[model samples]
Every structure is written in C-alpha cells, then in structure tokens.
Target: MTAPLWGAVPLQADEWRFGLWAPSAADVALRLDGTLHPMTRGPDGAWQVSCPARANLPYMFRVDGTDYPDPASRLQVDGPEGPSLTVDPSQFDWGSHWQGRPFEEAVIFELHIGTFTTEGTFEAATHRLADLAAMGVTVIELMPVSQFSGARGWGYDGVLIRAPQPDYGSPDAMRTFVRTAQELGMAVLLDLVMNHFGPFGNLLPAYVPEMFSDRATPWGAAIDFARPQVQAFFHEAAMGWLHDYRLDGFRFDAVHQIRDGRDQKVMRDLARDLRASAPDRPLHLICEDERNLPSLRENGYDAEWNDDWHNALHVALTGEHQGYYSRFANAPFDHLARAMARGQVDEGQPSPEEPRGAPSAHLPWTAFINSNLTHDQVGNRAHGERLISLVGETPARVIHAALLLMPFVPMLFMGEEEGSTAPFHFFCDPPDDDSCEAVRKGRRAELAGIGYEVDGMLDPCGEAAFDVSRPYPAEDADRAAAWRDLTRRLIDLRMAHIVPLLRSGKIGDGTVSRPTARSFDAAWRFEGGTLRVCLALGTPLGAVEGTPIFTMGDLARDAFALHVEITS
Candidate 1:
C-alpha cells in the first residue's frame, strides 16, 4: 500500500510522518500535542514533517496561522472540527483471509450505522451480522461513516474523507464489524461521497483553494479533479478505506454531480486502481448516477443504482406522482415494463426534468440494482414513510417480491423485511443554531417543492427527529412474522434459483408484456433455465401453471407470483 498524500502517517511505533498539500499556504507547521514543529516545503509544494510520536496523539496543522484538522484524518476521535488522532492500521488483527462474495450473488442490505441499533455503535452492529447473513443477505452496504459535523447526519456531509465517525466507534471497531460480516458470508460495501465536501468543518478550501474548481455542486465547492494533487487526495482516501478496513467495495454517491473534465476521469482511474490493489479479492464498485450512463458499467463499475425501477414501481404501487415521480406517473406501468425488459426507463427518452440517459438495454440485467425502498425514497419525503405505510402491507409485499424475483440485483433498505413502519427521517445534529436554522429552512423548501405539507414536517436539526429515525421491528407480531417469512422465502428462492443463473454473468435480457395497466408478465432466459414473474397491482392476471416459491395477496385480485424452470 502506498502512503497517502495527506494526513499523519505512522512510520514507526514511536515516529510519525505528517504530510499536507497546501499550495496557498506560505508557511505550515504541525501542532502535535501542543508543541509546534515547522513543516518543510518539498519540491512538489507539499509540506512535510517527521517527528517522534505514538498512536492516539492529537495533532493539527497550522497553515499560515489558523489551525485545521488533517484533511485525510484516519480518526477524528473528537468531532469533525476537533484535532485529528494518529492511528496504527496494524493494531487490528484480522483473523482470517476473507475473500468477498461476487457481485452477481449479491443480495444487498443498505443500512445507516447510526440508527441500525439503539447503541448506534460498530460493536452493536456487529452483534446483528448473523441475523443478516441468516436472512440470505450476501452484502451489507453501510451508508457513509465518514466524520461529519456534530453527533449525526447522513454521512454525506463528510469533511474528512478517510476518517471514520467517532460517534460510531473507533476505527478498529469498524474493522471488527466488517470482518465479522465477511466471516458470516456477507461482503460489506461503504457508501462514499467524493463529489463535494460538507458545508461545515471543511478546512481544505481555506488552505488549498486550488483543489476546488470555480463551479459548485449542490453540497459545496466542486472538486478540481483535473489537478493531479486533487485526484491523488480522493484516490488515496478511497484506497485507504479499501486496504485498511478490508472493505469489499464502495457505492459511490451521486456520481452524476461529479464532473471531471479530464480525459482520464478520476472515477474511472480510482476504480481501476482499487481492483488492481487487491486482485485476489472480489471487489465490486457501484454508482448512484442519474444520467443512466452505461459507460460506467462498461468501464470498471459492476452496477448502478436503478432509481428508474424504484420510481416507476413506487408510482404504480402508491399512485403518488409528486416531484420526481411525475416523470413516471403518466404511464408508470409502461415505464416499469420498460425498466424490467431493458435496464433503464429513461433510456434516451425525454423527461419532465430534461433529456435524460443513454442507451442501456445492451447492458446486462445485473448491471442495474433495483429496490422498492431506499434511504432517498423514504427520507426525502415530508414524512419518512415506508412502502408498507404508503400502500399497505399487501401491495408493498407484492412489489418487494417482484423486485427480489427480478433478474437485476436486489437491495433492501434497513427495516423493510420486518414490515417496520419507523420513519427514516432526514435528521442531523448541526454544530450550532445558525447551521440548524439553515438546515430547517432548506428542508422545508425541499419538502414544499415536492408537493408535501411542509408545515407539519419534522425539524431535521432536532434530537426528536433523530429519535424517530431509529428503526424498530413491526408492532404487530403476526404481520411482522409474515413479512419476515415472505422475505426469507423470496431471498432463498433467489439464492437457489436466480444466483446460479447469474454466476456466468451472461443473463439473457428479460421480455415483459403488460396485459393491463395494473398487471404484467416478465421472464428471463439463461443458459440452463428460464425464470418467470407475474405481478398484478390492483387487478389479477392469468396465473402460470407451476407452483411459485413465493406468493402474496389473492391471485384472483392484486397479487405477485414467481416461477422457475430448468432445461437440459
């Protein structure tokens, strides 16, 4: 593993090497435990200092005059704005050589670490690994755990790219959680935000203004990816996570917002390097791109989050076509039919927003990850309501069944399987009242634009909001049992039937037909067999001959069914 371009690097048990790229700073000094040591500017304009130190020592860089935490801090043991702590990666003893599961066999479970358990710590989450593995989840996708402001926020506001949030646990505890999951036959993928830094606690712009472009993203200043130093900063951050934590992969957040003008895009370079770094490991890289770009999958990415599938399915199931849902509201069933048959619903098609997407039908079905409920779909609402709450259990169950049974990879948000109605709200703990007010105002405007009742919306910056976001099992025991049973059956069937066919990564494209606006039949053919699914939202369709591994609702009315056949 190569040394990172920034942050404090522990060279020996009693010696530390600190490096910072601050082109704008005329002078730089390291404040390691109250003593100031001047950093010498290298030929490349980077400031470097080597000093006697040990692990857990608090340090900060005095750039020109103002002190700032290490931009590539490994452990912000305090909050994001506090001093950085030196950590030795060799401290954690990974007991076994755990190779990850293949992307084709993935049954991803995306969860937020803070709300995963009442304790909201990595050690607490470790205890639940067996339960997830037993549920047949092949991958556990954690939302960003990067150090952000205050005690909480969806990890997207991460200022320190490499540091694990101290609120969750120490860096070693995080490693333990990952290793435990891997031991239980589940690969762990971390959600990474590389597009822009958070609004607060980011001191990079103050010392290294050249790292950012004149343009800005929705979050903050746009990253100047064209610069070699800027590219190295992000590349090293991601690589450190992959190597140090033994993480299986990453889900790059909001890639559509990442605009790299260079001929060799930074994302592509990062993916290539990550896979090369661990050629023996099954490293999967996924993207959350709105453009529906196929090159990402064609290049080095394994798959992209198919929000098109969720949007179309949500509209068809809930009949609520506000905000982004309006694009599919006109003919959601048809859009869904396209999404299942091909890959993207917006494949070079016009939309209410803009002319979105490129041709995606040529891509393999597994290249798209489909889900009924995700953090974005739930938390972005005026009231974070799960699909079970929106259209009732029967309909939600059917949609979930259809999603899992599809040839595409399936992902479930944290509490969907148990029929938990706990609201996954957009909660955060801002550093101060001014930041709190800013969050409140922005959240209100966002909800109001979505045709929601903004006045009754929960305050995002309040502790009450965070409390409500912690998920719990369903209140009704019977309903919860039924939901769990159905989920287990569906995933079992997927593992047994769908997973084998996907192993070759040569899945035949699905053919879908809509008999009525409320019903559809879809099937995909692999080398050895054909997998079929029939779904009806508000009405019944003709049932297939064979008995389905999973069935929900009345087959004569609104229902979902799955059937499979093998050929010599």
Candidate 2:
C-alpha cells in the first residue's frame, strides 16, 4: 500500500517506524506495550507510527474497533492469536565466517523440528548437526518452522510466513540453528508455504480485504499474487530469511496451489527476485509440485522432489497398488528406468487420476531430488509406514543403494538413516469445531483418493498421535548402529566414485534388466569401469561376482559395479 517501506524499520538508535498496508480500514491504531497511539492513514491507504523499538516489545494493530496481529510480525511469541513481539534483528550474532555451500553435490536431510528430537526445540536439534555432518549430509532441509495456529501440524499450515514457531524456541534460536549448521559445513534450508495461510488467527483479510484473490485452493483463499502489494509482501518475506537468519536456501511446499492469474507469473518473478537478493550465495530454490514441469527449472528453481520416482519404486518393491500408484502396474522397472535416465516416465500422457504433467526428458538429472522416503510419502498414508517397514529393511536398503548412488541429488527423511522405525504421521492439534471436522473429512477423502482406507487412521487432533511420531533415541541400540554404518558406507561410495563419474559424463546410459520377476539388474558402463546393481524382490539377491563395495545384511553383495579398482 505504502511506497516500499515494508514492515517496521529502524530510524535511529531507539526510534522505529511501524508500517502496514490496511487499505480497507477507515481508522487504524498502533497498540505498543500497553498504550495505544492513533495511526494516520495516507491517501494510498497505508498506516504508520514511529516509536521506541524496545527489545521484545509486544505490539498489535487495532483496526477500527477489532484487535489484529501484525501480518508482517517477525516473532509471534505467544500463539498466532496473541500479540506480536519486536525482534531486534541486529541482536542476532552470527559469526562472520559463513561463505555459503554450492548445491552441485548437495545431500539433503528433511527434518521436522517438532519431531526431530526429544526436546523438539532448535537448541536440541543444534546438538545433532555434528552427527549429521559425520553422516556426510551437505544440507539439512528443515520442515516449515513458520508460525502456525496451534503447537504443530507439519508446519505447512503456517499463517505467518516470516515468524519462526514459538513452540520450538526463541527467534535467536532459529538463527543459532542455522549458524551451527553452516559451521558444520552444512547449509540449512527452511521450508516455506507461500500458497495460502492457515485457517485460524488469519488477520490480513480483517484489515485488507483484497489481500486474497478470487481463486481458491483446497487450503483457503489463494493469495493475490497478481497485485503488486501482494508480490512485495512475499518478496520481502523471502529476503527476511536470507538476511535475518542467513539461511542457505528455501523449499516451497506445494507451489501448484499458488494461482497467479496475470501476465507476469508470480513463481518465476519471485525466483528471479530471490536470486537477486543474495548475489554472492549459491542459494538453492526447490519445489514440491506433483507436476514435474521443466519450466520451473527453466525459470530459476534449482530442483524438485520427483514423487514419481518414489511412487513407481514403492509399488515395485512393496507390490502395493492403490491410489496414484495404479498406473505403474505394467512394468515397475521400466518406470524406475525412465526416472533414472529420463526425468519422468509419464511423458505428457494423461494420468490415471489427474490431468497433469508432460515430458521432462529435456530437463537435466540435477533438476530432481531422488529419494526413497520423504514426509509426504509416509505421513499422508492411512498408516504412516516408512519404506523400511513396508518392504523390509534389506529390500529398503537395496532401494536406498540406488537412491544415494544415482546422479540426481538425494534427500532423507528424519530418523530414516538410523532405521528408527518412527512413523511421521499427519498429526495436528486444531481446535474442536467445524474446521477440525473439515480436517478429518478432508484427510479421509485425500486418503481415499490414494486407494487407502481411513477406518483405523489416527486422529489428527489427538496427543497420542503426535507422541507416537517422535523418533525415540534408541530402544534397539545395536540395530540402529548397523543401519548407521550401512548408510555411511553407501554415502561414502557415492561421494568417492559415483558423483565424480556422473559429473564427467563417464557413466553412460544405464540399462535396467530383470533376470526374473523377483529380481532386476541396473548397469552403467563408465570409461574407467562399470557399475551394476542386482536387486531381488522379497529375497536375498545373487552375487554379481565383481567386487563388493558395500553390502546389506547377509546378501553378501554390494550395489556397486564389478571389475574395478575401488575398495570399500
């Protein structure tokens, strides 16, 4: 609304000017600490007031007669329903030694702060970055930490796009968490939901009615990215994470819902602007859209999580065909091969359920995040089952071998490396009302879409569901140790040989051949040598007779190729 003075800005040592866009509000007042000062609105419908910027000063916006929280607030100390707090960005002390990490060899670990540790706090997660570094993780992808209504709900339902969730820790704790990760040579990527705001405690519409567009998403009203004001809001929010926290990158959740009905596409513009914001850093931008559109990378985004790979590979290994997986029934290995060699297997064909996607063979191998497990793949199901439980540990490890050794970038869900057996269920703690019922019914319909039943699904609002999802330290210490070692060895092999060969284009077109319906072999010939993997379904695979670089259990064979000089 106002020219370009976004949010609150410091004028002098203690003087700060509070600003907001509430074009629809006739009268506005700024409530700081306890006293309320009437704010003057300009002809353009922007409001402002300058006052003392005290540390941790609590404030709110009183529009007309209704009290509302600042939509641009950096820290929501209390819940989203409570007053906003002043977070002095200058006080956060990140050391001067952060030079940023390149994403060419990125290995991401997707973690939910609320369920990553026993404490579920940023400080608690900070203590574990060293261990992750030892595991050879290059980037730690944090689940959305943005402020949401209740304590937790996978953080996708965040209302405040900039503020960190108070339930996790202080605002400084978020900064410390990123600083610690960078100190360990691992970049921290924050997941953000820019499509729609959460249902409860949303105050933007209360002040500015045009903040939302006529277009609607399944979550709520679609943001009016067509408007210049709305575009500025998101642009500034992305800059906040880049400047305030020095976050290495960002992962946008379900970007398909961001409907920008205009001449200038919002996603492309936002990507261009974010890259301009940090010119010195190799800031990566990732998307989680079902449509593996190549234009997303052409625009400026770094990568996308290839769910096709997960679904195709999951059905192949577990032999479960339901929901979106029914299309991969013909030849599962072919589906896997297309994803490995080509970007996607569907090839612009009309999908079984939705009218989505096109051919992406033109896209490079670096355009997708190849992984066997992720939060959405596991949690969205009727029962939150990780790949390990569905296909058994040995088979899951065989799949993991292909995932980590492949040319594309790879990601791991939290606790997956150690085989913790924890269920990352879709749990929420919304209030008891019609909105809550809508969530239940919506989840039921969503699971039904995927060929799953909701008769025994865990109640999203129940505390027991949230409690059961936490990754307990170790009930089975020895098994955890074995999983950790196996994962470490596989990662070492990828970094030591596979990635180098792929970069130099020495790994030629890979071939996937099935010896029997029970097993398949994927081989790639390199100028130096060859890499072959034999995966047997439901049983231990036969020895390849080359060299065993890494082995899973009593299979007595590794996923690497034969007749090479490599040693493990």
Candidate 3:
C-alpha cells in the first residue's frame, strides 16, 4: 500500500497538478480544456499528471477509461452535471492592502446575496456596499456563494468550493464584489460548509470512494475528515479562498456534524497552518456548533455563533414558546444580563437540554439577540414570518437597538434596519421532481412540531421560493432614506461609545439596579459617567411601573431627549 503522503502534490503557478490515489484503475487520463491527457502511474498506485500547456484550463479526471469529474474542481459552468470550466482566479487585480481589523473592533453584517437584493447578482449587491459602510459595519458576512445545483439556493448545498454561483454573476463579478467591499473598507467573511455535501448533484463520490463517512448528520453522512488524503484536500480548500480569492475569513457551517475520531482532527491542524500562512490577516474562524463552548474555544476557532443568546432573546421579546424555544422561554434576565457582562451565558452548570451536559467554564461569545429572524429561522418556519410579524414592530425595533448596543459583536440581516415586511423564504431554481419533493418533505419535517401546517412553507428547490425571497425594490425612497438614517445613527452610537465601554470591561455583571418584572415590564438604573439600562414596556406582564428607567438620573433635568419603546 502507498504511504499517505504518496498522493500529495504542491500547488504551482499556471499549471495544475493532481495526484489521485486510485490503486485499481488500469488507466487514468487528465481531461484539460476538452482534451484527454494520459496520466503517468507512479509507484504505490498513485496516478500523477501535470499540464504545462493547459494554463487556466478547466479539467477533470477520467478514471479507468471512464470520464469522471474532478472532486475538488474550483470552477463549474453550471450544476454538477454541467460542464466544468477552468478559471484563472489570479487575473483580478486587487486594490486594497491586506490590512484586517481585529475581532473586537469588527461590526459584522450577515447577508445571503440572493436575498440581499432584488437582482440577486454580485453586481447588483455591489450597489449596497455604501449602505453597509455607512452603518459602521466593518465586515460583511456573506452566506455561502459557492456553486450548487439549480440556479438559486441557500448556498449550503454547494459542491464547487472555489467558484461563486454563476447566477450571481460570473467569477469576475464575485471578484468585483469582494474588491468593491474591500475598497469600501469592509472585510468579507464567507460561510463555508465543510460538514456534508448536498444531496443533489454532488460529484465527489465519482472520483473518490469513502470520501463520505457512514456516520450520519442532520444533512447526511458527514465528510470523512479523518481519512489521510482528505485532510490535505480540506486544507487546500480552506487556503484556496485566502490565497486565491482573497477572502478575509470563514464562517464554518455545522462544524459539530464533522465527525472525526482521530486524536488530531483536520480543523485543528488547518487552524495552525492557516495562522502560519497569513499571520498579518486576521484568520477569523467562526463555527455553528451548539454542543459545548469550551470545545470550540479550545479547538482553535476564533469565535462561534451564539444560538443560545438568540433563543433567550427571542423568547424574551417575542414570547414564542414553540419548538426549541421551550428550553429557553423561562430563561431569566440574568442570562441576558450575564451574556452582556461576561460574554457567555452557559458559563457553568449542566445544560438541561444537550446530551453532553454543560460547559465547564465561561468562554468568550458573540451575542445575537435577533439571529432568529435570519434566513434559516424564517425560511424554516411553515408560515415564514419575519421578526416584525412574530413580535410587533416596536418590540422588534427595541430588541434590534438593544442588540446593537450590546458588548458582543452583533450581526444584522438584510432589510432589518427598517423592518422589511417580506419573508426570506428558502429558495432554489430549475428543480426536478426528486429535488422538489425532497425540499418539500425536508422543510415540512423540520417544522412538524412547531404547531403549524408544514405544507405551506416555501420549497427551497422550487421557483416560487426564490421569487418570494427577493428583496423589495427601492420604490419608496422616503422609507429607504429613513432606514438609512436610523441604521447610521445606531451604528455611530455603537462605534463611538459601546465598543470603548466593552473593551474597558466597564459594564460588569450587567445588572439592572432598578425595577424588576414578572413578564415584560422591566426597568433598570445605572450609575457612573456612562450608564447602561434596560427597560421593557410592552412585556407580557404589562406596562412598567415607571416610564423611562432613568440612566444618568440627571438627564431628566437636562435638555437630553429620551428614546422610549415597548420591547415586548
């Protein structure tokens, strides 16, 4: 048997060299630019080939005389079944210097490009960069833009890791988006799914067997990260965006689903290597794992999505007690209080819900009060209600403002600034019967226990879902102007004061020293030059005893205006 390193090849300029560990193949040809170039079989059953003539050419492998696509193909013209194209990613001239902002100073805005604008193209989304910059947003957290089956998708189903979706404009258009955002001083954080491939049009299995494990996940069998060559494959994939695409950072999707039993998993080693490769650029690694806090912190990731904070804040403000909200409904204000103060909620004590019990100690966390209104939450719902619909407009606005002012890094979804009434439905395009049926069944199954009929939720693989998720056009200029004003003000406030307070650790233990409430009615008073207070007027319990829980008590006597809202 060949050693694990036998199939390893270094990345070189212009020419692409691939080594395949297919021991049983009689012949393997490297298909480059529509021509088949026969590969040389080396010792240890490794098939090796290099094409110096085929610079910037799209290619795949033909194994055992049968045409098979590259499992790690960077660019594809269409879906997995469509023609693959060679892309020269280095052609784009990047203008911005590779200076990255520290995590503490970053104000992130998470958006799905397809739903961010009506046009749903990279060029179309470019028009909104000024809006993001004006909102004091330093980083734009783009949902996965990789190529997947069909024209429209949430991007989690992506197979071609390097190529952006063709429907969202071309690879050049993607470079334009990144370069434009960079020019506007916004770092791009890409949401990358490394756990499992989508069910439709995944061509990885054609070139490599046992690439996916028998171990199951919510999506499907997890990718085999423990395998020898697989580690190098993922490492290259991670570095490709940084080295080739110039992406600032990555947000790992469902990292908990990556099942690896080895002593040193691929993620840890990749983290070490990534840190080494680009020491100057902030290699921000964020994960969507709910298992435990310490494991993620110790795993070398920079940050993790805080779903607990979302759940707690959603239940507190919206009073929606269905599905997983059951565990978080009775969550005390202390939870939110401590989260803002200490940065983590589940610092100690066994988690009543998780099978793995509780976190041993407090870990730094990013708190999200309104992550529930995201594409996943809204699209997953049977009725697909926006946050404004679930909780009234006033409450939603108050909660949003509160979240923005919190110590942890806050993320806002598209159209959230002015309470966009349209629902962000799950959407896809050019769907077949099986793809459509699977989407329908899967969405329904997800919302089965949410006390709503599942048949109505928009099918992600259907045309209607894509149509429904389109952003409202800028027809109402006045409303759009008002939204810009509000967002700018909030962001300016955060940048001017909130960041400094949090950095100094001035807001200790997040205590509301004034009025307490049973349901929604709440008020708090604070001392010191800068006071932090929380008052909920439209809580379920009823109106608060006193209006405007005065922080900086002398404000009552001054000409300062107090902003009041019912955060029910």
Local distance difference test, per candidate? 0.85, 0.77, 0.65
lDDT tens readout by residue for model 2, 1-568: 3244346666778887887778888888988888898888877677888888776888888888887777878987588877888777887778776878767678899999998887889999999899988988889999998898888678988888888988899888888999889988999898988888888677677777878977778777788887777777787788787788988889988887766675338888878878887888788899988766777888889888888888888888878888667878767766776766675776677655555577676565667888888888888888787888876766676667667766678898888888877777898868667777878888888898877878888877777678778865555999888878877877888888766654554444556665545455666555545556555554444555556555444433433222222322
**Could you give the candidate ranking by TM-score, starting with the highest?**
1, 2, 3
- Runs with alpha carbons beyond 4 Å of true place in candidate 2: 1-5, 40-44, 262-264, 350-355, 433-438, 445-450, 505-568
**TM-score attained by model 1:** 0.96
Clashing pairs in 1: none
Alpha carbon lDDT at 251, candidate 1: 98
Candidate 1 structure quality by residue, lDDT tens digits, 350-409: 666677889887887889999989999999998898888888866776778878877899
Give the lowest summed-lDDT range of ten residues in model 3: 552-561
Instruction: Compute each candidate's TM-score over C-alphas.
Output: 0.96, 0.91, 0.86
Across 1-568, the per-residue lDDT of candidate 3 in tens digits comes to 2222222233465455666656567888877677888888776456777666433456667887676555556666566655556555666888757687767667778888887887888898999898788778888889998778777888988877666777788777877888888888888888988887777777667656667777777767677887756666667777777776677888888777776686446777777777788887776777776664556557677777776667677676667778877766665555555444554566545657554324522443332222535667776667667877777655665566656655557777777766676777777653578767776776677678576676656666666777767656454678667766766777777676655554443322333332334222222222222434343533332222334322211222322112322121
TM-score attained by model 3: 0.86
Q: Given candidate 3, what's the lDDT at residue 219? A: 69
The pairs that clash in candidate 3 are: 58-86, 520-539
Q: What is the lDDT of residue 60 in candidate 1?
A: 91
lDDT of model number 1: 0.85
